[model samples]
Target: MSLSALLFPSDAMAQQSGIKRIDLQRHDLSVFGYETVQARIDFEPGTAFGMHSHPGEEVIYVLEGLLECKFQ
Candidate 1:
């Protein structure tokens, strides 16, 4: 399946849920002695983020959406 298909089963679902994403920034972590990335995310009702991973670390804060997360 395509990446978007893997992440979102349906385009209608993605749109209905108001899934908006912005790649805030990216940088070479060598200067910080660790590899990491960060960004701001917005999710509307019915939106879901598929299972994924990071190389080093990750942190997330809920700006909204009842602050729920699902994993498999």
Candidate 2:
């Protein structure tokens, strides 16, 4: 298993009860099982994710806010 960090807006957080979201299921994470993805997500001010991806070919999307994404 892997671990990640994140943040969310008060209103959004209130709805989720202070839970952040860093989704790894970005358009089939299974495609890249040889990669290490790390990043921070904050919604208080805004939402952002750092570099994320595995080896081989894959597709990704934030589905919400803009993603500062990079592949390695």
Runs in model 1 with CA error above 4 Å? 1-17, 31-35, 70-72
| Residue-by-residue lDDT tens digits, candidate 1, 4-67 | 1112222343444456544455567675664344455556556566665434544556554465
List model 2 lDDT by residue over 1-72, tens digit each: 122323222234334522354543333344454433433333433433444433353334344544454545
User: Which sections of candidate 2 miss by over 4 Å?
Assistant: 1-53
Q: Cα lDDT of all candidates, in order?
A: 0.46, 0.37
lDDT of 1: 0.46
Clashing pairs in 1: none
